[model samples]
Target: MAVISNSLQIKHGLSLWCPQSASINRTHRRSSIGLGRVLRRSYVAASSAFANENREFVIVGGGNAAGYAARTFVEHGMADGRLCIVSKEAYAPYERPALTKAYLFPLDKKPARLPGFHTCVGSGGERQTADWYKEKGIEMFYEDPVTSIDIEKQTLTTNSGKQLKYGSLIIATGCTASRFPEKIGGNLPGVHYIRDVADANLLVSSLERAWKVVIVGGGYIGMEVAAAAVGWKLDTTIIFPENHLLQRLFTPSLSRRYEELYQENGVKFLKGASIKNLEAGSDGRVTAVKLEDGSNIEADTVIIGIGAKPAVSPFESVGLNTSVGGIQVDGQFRTSIPGIFAVGDVAAFPLKMYDRIARVEHVDHARRSAQHCIKALLSAQTHTYDYLPYFYSRVFEYEGSPRKIWWQFFGDNVGETIEIGDFDPKIATFWIESGKLKGVLVESGSTEDFQLLPKLARSQPFVDKAKLQNASSVEEALDIARASLTS
Candidate 1:
């Protein structure tokens, strides 16, 4: 077949089809080839016309969203349609959140492995394995990523030269971790990132011999890694340009509360400082980290968690509407193109509750958005995606302490004024704008209390400043808000 920059195809006259020769046997054969080899060596010679004639549905990613979409499809009586999932990952969709948390837990804690953290299981559903796919007549293309897509032609070409056409497509490409320039020692042997299971495994292995570890960025990933490192008895230091942890999200009081807790756990913090360059030994392994403030700290391992950017290359050649965040999707998770949908971190969707468009990178969003997209596809439903913004972070626990510092936030945290309830073991903040409650945040709150906060925020109840100032507890404020709805 002719290739145009390994992406576009100018052969408009070509028809679409999917030959039965590409189907796997019912015996469930597993390929032993490594992902790198499969992408480079294994080739599938199918034309776009052949694929289109056969395929009914196709998903372009293998993360949380893809996994849930598969479950949604099968649940909705889609047992026999030709469904295919193309993914660069060798493993099936597993819990992406565990990589930065439980997967890094001490060996005694027994970190999760394949089949354990698989999709649908996170949402109390069945774990669909390779055998499950076979039983359902679904085909999976692992380690072979789609290098290009022809939207008008409804075709996808993988890195291995396999081509397929679909009646409907779901894009769940997820996001990529951010790193520093290679000139600054970002490519050193001990430098690490945690975006997938492979990255977490590598970092976990490094922790066994790591004494002094440097963590970059103050985002939840950096904070969580620091908590785990110190919990494992390693010397951990966090460096970020922000004056406090979670500077972009948490207020000064909440940041200080968590920062103090981290310090109490013996984790050092180097705030308001950026990495000048990484120092390495003759062997090219990192040895130390130099800060922009003219200070150097010993580092046996380094973890970078600066941020993430949407994985949008597969959609680039398709001329889809995109923003700096990700592919812009409607309330139903449909893209600008017909019969196409985008979800999870790669989709910048409209947040109806906030009357604004935003993209969330959390696992909850991934699971819900995928389910919504599948509903819209299978039923032609015009349901509006009204998702309440929610996120949480769990940090360190000292020796002999069974307590874990965890916090969950719901609704929008942006407002003209903020009110606090308490800041000890429990930290609660309410964001108010023009006497209207806009958001609620709480740390170490009970399940009932946490659940009530979001409902109150969604109600957008009118508030009196005097009642907020005189409120004894979060529960009291919740009671007042609840009464307002009734009154």
Candidate 2:
């Protein structure tokens, strides 16, 4: 049986992984291992067999989590022919968030774009280049997908019939967008879903000739696309089945505020409505979308952003446990089968911070969890992962501001929200909960707010609710929070 650690970090800076009693028992058992020499030798033989079969740690994805893990493993003296990354995509890992803004903007004043597989400077400024990975001695197998995993033999077969063995495996395969139901005419040419850079490129190509674009689902992706379309002076309509935008995330009041912001930017919204069927023109392009209420809206293009389903089919036949469409892992990122681990959007683990089962899709969560997994791989022991949830998005102006600002955090359970800068039309709201700062949402605040909020959220014991609400500035809020924690 695999040993699992039960630990939770509480007050003070110290981390508690296992109980003191349990540690003492483990130590005592190690000292009395004279009678278990035969069992120990057998275990050593099995481990040695695994080590000889595959000298390198094989990672089965090329995303942020996989890149970070590869770096972390190498940095910790695990290098020397001991690490390889296999990514199905042709390009190396690159940031996906900026594809809508920086990549699509004009040359002279474009935002910072993500680095691609090859270093080609577009209109945007210089980002981190992919060649840096090769410089660091990392081996990458691009466009190679592992089709099957032989768990007992610790071997993997790729789509190209290349077979490789591994002592340990890390699955970082992320999710894909949920497809429209088959009966609703989803196979239409002009209907598309955004999941990767390729999808974004296709949408941009379609937008060139699209007179009107209809987006299904009012989540962040849909809203961000709507904002971009409105910025480009395109006819954009957002159809949401929910009555309010971002209903699943924020309060109705906040959703209304966002609705007003979008409306001011000339983006039309269709609330409490669902698409019944899509109609294609004679040219084999989408011409209109028929609503469940029997109403039809003209459209040249339709983008589906309804959300994602876990990319877990590759691991399903291997008998890996999963919950809610993601692979299940323990605190140490270890799957049900030993020597195999998983992380990022694909791993469903119990969240110590939220006190619930969670599968986070944010960059910060992926990085932190990957770090913990690397630490576990090194020590060969269970390590508890504890990190605060963080997320952000770029939205339209608060009032009539021409500048673009960011909204960092939004959640109802978080206590009073404090705002800074011009709160009139442009505003920044910081959510505080239980005398601790939880998150911040910026509409027209400085980019510095994004850099500082995540750190403040992690270092707990936030400010008092009353003090935070009445604070004059961010500096004052920080001071008050510090004082409250110490007091």
Candidate 3:
């Protein structure tokens, strides 16, 4: 039997066909091998594409916003991909506010140190272990700093030269403490800024050995730190350039209230003061701080809780617009850059009620913002981030007396704050606006009032201001508020 073969070739303007015999078998074998190689390449390409398709949602920063975002996404069934959270810190995301208060207290009082099963404990116990993220199928890259973002290419490059592609990206980068320049001895071993768990730990360690601690900045952070230090029986003094604490955020009267709280707890206040120079010992530990008033205060440790600047460098590098030291996002938490969203302390969002853009660093804000972002991501709906801001700080006493609690609320169009339950000038005050309950200032009078404030704030149609103030007891006031809201 004779085998027949045909060779066909086509050129620019010509075609040729030749019939052959012996070469046909060899040609057929080569063609089969070539086809197999093409198929294999296609299969491998498809596999690569599949792997890329399964790439997780990438979130920068492992703070409250990032953790809340991860949890929200998982709860909404949007936790596909790897849900990678890259944090510069080695530990998982922990409660930051608690760091300055509870964590600084004795082990028994610190929530993180409590041994029993607590609902607040994430996948692992406190201290933000990675297992929490792992439990939610989230991947964490700790101690990894994202250096640059390639927006056009949808890629991020780390400082270590690693590149990651993201299907969706969230810039919850949070913020960093505003440090004084090294020339002013800001970088000294004894000078510390509180922004993370590590900083708190360092401060705690320093407090152990120090006899006197001077905290610069009379903002909430500094005041909270002072309260914590004083609670631990340390001689602590707070230096505030302003006449009051949280002057930037609250009215003079409110700030004065905070000042009084700290003072009552045996924390010294140096208002309208500045640090002239940090006197150091031979061992490089801060021995004292020279004040601008020509008076030198002995300071074993100096904590600078001056303020914070948004951690928006990565987003800025990607050409995402920012304002008020935070990434500007639209109603849906979508940044000016497409495929990117931001939230928490690092996101400047429009406040319809206040008719301005506001950025709050409270945990509630972080949680609500993350929830809004997650809802938007899942439903593809456009919802404005318009939750009212609320925050609280724990006040501890130097003596054996009970720790006082202070809380504030800011409202718009709400009317007349009502005072109830003895209206102790040193304890608590309720702010009622427009016949509606608005703000509650609590020191030690009622825990119920503190808990009820947030609920009423959200429920709107707040408590009956008249009835609340006229009520004989906190329980009566709460019942009136609940009834008013329901009615």
User: For candidate 1, what is the lDDT?
Assistant: 0.74
lDDT of 2 by residue, 1-487 (tens): 0001111111112121211101101221111313322111011223443455453577888766776676677668775466778888777765555555444442334434445422212213233245656666667788888888876666778888777676677888876677887577676888887766677777777776678989888876787777766655678899989889765455466677778777887789999997899998898778998999999989988888777766776787533333334677666676655567788878766667655556666655666777688777775555477656656676442333364646665322356656553444455466666656666555544555456655556655546677767877655655565565456
Tens digits of lDDT, candidate 3, 1-487: 0000001000011111111111001111112213222111011112353454334478898777777777777777766555787788767776566666666664434433322222124334243346656766777788898988866556777877767767568888877888878876787787888877678778778877777888998766787777777766788899878777765444466566566666777788888888778877899877888887889999888998877777888677533333344776666676645457788888766665445566666766776787788677666454467766565566563234365565555343233445444424333445565566555545453565666667776666645555666778656666776687778
Q: Give, for candidate 2, the lowest lDDT window spanning 10 residues.
A: 1-10
- What's each prediction's TM-score? 0.86, 0.78, 0.77
* Root-mean-square deviation per candidate: 10.6, 7.3, 17.8
Show model 2 residue runs off by greater than 4 Å. Answer: 1-55, 106-130, 317-323, 379-382, 395-401, 410-442, 447-452, 459-483
Which residue pairs show collisions in model 2?
A: 398-425, 399-425, 407-442, 409-440, 435-462, 436-462
The global Cα lDDT (0 to 1) of model 3 is: 0.63
Q: Which scores greater on lDDT, model 1 or model 2?
A: 1
Cα lDDT for residue 476, candidate 2: 64
Determine the C-alpha RMSD for candidate 1 after optimal superposition of all C-alphas.
Answer: 10.6
